[model samples]
Target: MQTVCRDAPGCPEPGPGYPDLGAVPLVALNVSVRRRLGLYLNPRAAVAADWAALAEALGYEYLEIRALEAQPDPSARLLDDWQGRGGATVGRLLELLRDLGRHDILAELRGRIEEDCKKYLQRQEQPVQVPAVDSSVVRTLEMSGITTRDDPYGNVPELFDAFICYCQKDLHFVQDMIKELEQTTFKLKLCVFDRDVLPGSCVWSITSELIERRCRKMVVVISDDYLQSNECDFQTKFALSLSPGARQKRLIPVKCKAMKNEFPSILRFITICDYTNPCTQKWFWIRLAKALLVP
Candidate 1:
């Protein structure tokens, strides 16, 4: 265990005012208002391998998902439009990093190592060898004799490979569909109505945040009820606004039942996946898996 300077998030040597954050539980740290001042919750753990510690040091709020949580239906979260939606699997995030140059990444690793060491001290853990800023060599570091050299964000591992948003009324069918897809090992991060919302989080605010910042792509489970609900309108509108490319590319409309097209003007160009066909569920999952895996 040793005291070290991470200095990320523009904080001083120990990382802002709460120097002991390295010792705090990540879950608790996430809810602490003081720690969220400068940090953005990194859903992709590229910047810090041990995002738990990074959150403590930088005051990042929100759960940083390295891999999606375990689930029964994997396809529930798999994005169907990866190429058009600007999403790459964990494998792609790795390729992107490697393409940026290994030495440069190693330099970043060195800084992250230092930060991890400080955080480890709070856990009564051993310190590992971390490189200095000028050091060019990438040494394998071990705590308790275990090496830590893997990229945290670059790998496709989890159930429900993507996050899906829909009205609660459709959960019965959605869950069944997701279950079928999970047989193919697609994991999803679909939002469960009441279980997912924490007490402190504003429901509307959280919904907007998830649609805008969390989901790689947004799917609207289209039905007559969905189109008529105010809540549904809010979510679909938010999804349309956060889309990265042309509206047609990102907003996916899944027609589960008979429904009228009530999309806003911005979402007019979006593509619709009418699951009305007998094979729509299977075909959509296959397409989605390919999209998430290939690019």
Candidate 2:
């Protein structure tokens, strides 16, 4: 039986002259066919160099070499040199790539990319064993591989440039808000406790840093319990520690629970944002976003 195939634009088709006994199954040939996938190098020369060992380790096979550089021949020679070196360097490079690849994508995209990378690696005859990953490794990989210049979230800047200062009592609430905010294109680098505190940092230092410099805005989750806690007091006080010349107002008092009296002395200057009213909460995020000046 003769099989008709879709030919490329302006490309001639193999006709009756083409030798085909039709004895072989088409699926068998298609099964081993390599896929054209994207592999980006930080310096870009990695592809042109045909660093197969490096490519193999990174689970890449072919490089769609770019035309910007004039000496493609020399680049090929470099790849030949690297390949013949027994690929110790390539192995190391692959290890680094595997460790670093996890962090470059958003939550949704990360898993798919990882699976694809593994499959590609397997096809290249250098199947990489999965390694146990920790948050630090993930963070390192993410920061290293991210293609965007400085912005962590690609084109979308965070919704709140300011730091979010809230008590542990409202962790769930803050987390929920963060989840909701992420669903939108409006991003916020909201600093909640537990999540933002670097593992090695001293507790008080982390507190001080988040309040003092890291955050562009301060959001105090107000409730009687939060006001009573020493930890909360220190955090709030540090947030209020900003000098007069700071670009945005230092405090945004979010009334998480209704109170008969006003907020404490330090928070009294800023207008209260009541979370009770949906409109107020919406307005609070809007104003907080505005204060952040996120583009």
Candidate 3:
């Protein structure tokens, strides 16, 4: 897994008088905290005057103000500033935390920030899993290093034909689907999270770019776990935003374990590929392959 510090570049390092958070696990600084901070900061609502007031009131240094201003999005810039703190950053952050009456959250954030700094200093290499592609055609394409430049359709060049959006709980089933798809006559290039995301790259950036702009299709593994996951929700919404209405067909929802009612209001109406049915499993993949335009 990519270290949290890399994802939040310039994260503050622990200085004198702060609680030592060296022992905190890297996983403890997960997406939830980032999401929470994003919601809390509401960067879009912060005006120029508010920033100037904050800087003057907090005595923020040039580096801090510059860092905060660099991010185009409010939430992202907030995260960057939060992570990018050092001695000065920590002091300012602490004051803000105290004013907000979020000491408990600050304590948790302190641990995560310290842990991230340590990981960045260590230059750790995140372990990456090689993607498992079942289709012989895709395997051959991978070996041959074929790319979207070779596409006969003259569409926007894509690194992969499809990006698979699924929860960790559905990995086994997804792997099985990949294997079955491999046997199909058509070549399917898929971007599975565990396998495709390069080590050290920001997970959110890579996922967003691929799912929303780069990939030709998005295959969502629909399940209870998927619906509940914040990251999955983001991926689904981002994909849906790009392809709405009948164009929503670009988003292929595979029913792995979710009930009809469990699906979000927007997704309930779409024709889902029900992989949950044993009798129709074969037919489902075949139909899915056809929908994906498998040769």
Candidate 4:
């Protein structure tokens, strides 16, 4: 939060007239929004030593995580703590939330905070410089199925660094994947089904097109939930079909956790990255990012 000024789509702070968003108080946010934010951070309880995704996303050090997750308002405490350390702002919080792939929450937080700022400015008779809602945020939420879709794919080609296929059960892990690959130095664009795919399209058709034409590589998150998903089966097999014998190095199977069942026989020919193994953890993101680099 005190690190960068990287503002994101959705979060509008320093208001139409207010400047210096780098230190907006948490009190500027609505109570309901603060409570909603706790829904994501409190229960996660990421301690400093774990190198947990939440900790990474928020850039928290030491066991300071518990101090941020304090009750009544964990999100508020987190923001206050970051601000107290200097350089905390609404824009920085938005950027961190984006890294966590919680743009849905970002949109809500942004709107409420803006509304509060607007009211305060109006009472002061301050000139309001209300810019239009960020179109990119709108378009993003639309494509992610959080808002109305006005032909999401028509304006842009679907080409991407990789398409991530995972069960909802593994969304947190996938979010971590996003934080590392898309947010960090890798800067890889990941087409997550839930976040990037347009809603209401025929799932099978869209999935097939993305696997075959849109993405350069396929990342299949393998776990019990994924194994039970019929849709994952189709996407997995379809990717394999396009790159038979693993000739293209196109399909990257990431085994994140232990499971009762054996790894799928078909994927046996290809080597899998074991994320649960401590030895490989150091090189996991590096290996995955390298595999995703376009040939």
Candidate 5:
């Protein structure tokens, strides 16, 4: 239910004095945030004095430790200190990273962090419906280490960036596609049949999983040869079925070669990449990469 307000035709107040209602906050450190940030900062370290300065300001006596084994990451130690400092938030850390000129790592992290924050705020605005449960059941669930914080899809991680759908005749193009998309700086993980599929696995079962769950997008290589192959036909249709009306834009059609047969009627609405174009070759990979990146 939505309550339209006088602020705008379709707008409404989120709550009383909405913007200041803590709907969006500069998130403080938690175990998950620490673990994520630790990974990003692990490979990039500030000077010892810089870290020491930040630590000292945050009430830590020293950033050093005496140990027989390799020390815990300085980044992790800093995050722990930040947590203990009573809500030293991510915004403060971003300012430090920016000042240190770690822009190489800062660009992606800052973009993703901002996006995640926006999502968090949006989620906070939505009404939550908590079902009634017995106190004993709630305790049992807690004892079993289950909570509302658990990710629904955490167990089933998508292993491939995109699934390459092509016929054997188009394998050479797929090889080239891999060279351009995966081998270069893009470093995309593509699920190609010959390269990624297990030798003894059930083909139909595995292919279904790859299309439906494992991969984020399905790159369909279209050509006269590709149209002739039954497997390519099946895979294309299956991918389309999963995202009817192309709602997710998960099915990406690439015209690797001139096609004598008509384009699939089902995919007519989709804007495809035409490799046949000589002028747009330079921008093709970048455009495709951007498409794959869109969440």
Candidate 6:
């Protein structure tokens, strides 16, 4: 029946003689009611501006308008300019708030904004779908060993000692691993998807052949993202096919995250090097180098 300021320090109640607003939600309040009742709100223009800035910093611009709406004297021009920007985030928040019918506490709103942003980013970060290698193509590569024949470095029978199979999202971790391996005394040649594949070459052609024939061992960087990727799935299957009897020797699993429960059924039996643990990093490199049989 009465308007309450949820954002301010004291949760200030509306003054005497002010209209009751009759449980109408702030979002649905008409411009006339807002113009009359807005003065009683605790967060003045300055505080509202600070809230807007905080929301923008958290990557939720939608909260900016809602923040301004809490102010006693919000700038109409500023609200118009914010709406003009027209981001998906703003639209999403507006819809969510409208459906809820009331504003939440500022802290609760901040948490919600962060969670929504993270989910949105995760959706956008989905791995690029790499076309699956045809069964006929797999058989052809296996029978002819065309990967070796097509190799630019013909004389060197072993094109790469180890192939680093990973999701593109984990590239930063993979790059760091490559850098560390390079710095080591071991004479190990690593094959990475981005660096090893020749420019203008079809991605599937390079990846499939390299996993099937060229690389002696495949170091699969396991994570939730990796499990969901078609490319990683294809590469892992090919690597597993190469080592029928002894998979551990040919296919090494490196745990970039705790993925034992989510790992593929075929690979579950094998021991995984837990690189996710900071204390085990040195040991992880040693174990992986040994697995690759680095000289």
Query: In candidate 4, what are the lDDT values of residues 36-147, reduced to their tens digit?
Result: 6667655553432211344556677757765544434445455444534545455566556667666556665665655654443332232233368565654433333311
What TM-score does model 6 achieve against the real structure?
0.46
Quick one: ranking by lDDT, best first?
A: 4, 5, 3, 6, 2, 1
| lDDT per residue as tens, model 6, 16-75 | 533233322122212222232223222445433333443454355575658655543543
Which candidate leads in TM-score? 4
On TM-score, who's better, 4 or 5?
Answer: 4
- Scored against the true structure, residue 134 in model 1 reaches a CA lDDT of 25
Q: For residues 1-295, what per-residue lDDT tens digits would candidate 5 score against the true structure?
A: 2221213223234555333212223332223344565566555345422444445455554324222013355555555434434445555565455554445445545445545545444423422335674454443332221212222334424367899999898899999989988999989988888876645444555576668767899999888887567577657756765675578989999989887766654355689998889999888889988888777
**Residue 90 lDDT in model 3?**
34
lDDT digits (tens) for residues 1-295 of candidate 1: 2232232232234445333533322111111111221122223356533323332333323442223123111111122122234432322322333333333333344344334334323333323435675222222121111112223232321222334556778877677656755544665444444434435434455455455544455666777667556566656645543554444355566767755653322233455666776767568766654443431
Candidate 6, position 102, lDDT? 26
Candidate 5 residue spans exceeding 4 A from truth? 1-158
Between prediction 1 and prediction 3, the one with superior TM-score is: 3
Model 5 lDDT, full chain set: 0.59
Cα lDDT of candidate 3 equals: 0.56
Q: Candidate 1 — what's its lDDT?
A: 0.41
Cα lDDT, all candidates: 0.41, 0.44, 0.56, 0.64, 0.59, 0.54
- Ranking 2 against 6 by lDDT, winner: 6
Compute the lDDT for candidate 6.
0.54
lDDT of 3 by residue, 1-295 (tens): 1222222323454455433333322222334454555454534344222333345455667777676666444443443333323232333444554454444445556565554435423322232335675454443333222233434332334466678888898899889877877645656767777865545545555566677656778888887777578677667755664655435468888888746434543454467889878888778878887776632
Per the 3 Å backbone cut-off, how many clashing residue pairs does candidate 6 have? Answer: 0
Error of 1 at 169 (Å): 2.2
Candidate 1 residue runs with Cα over 4 Å from true position: 1-161, 244-248, 260-268, 279-282, 289-295
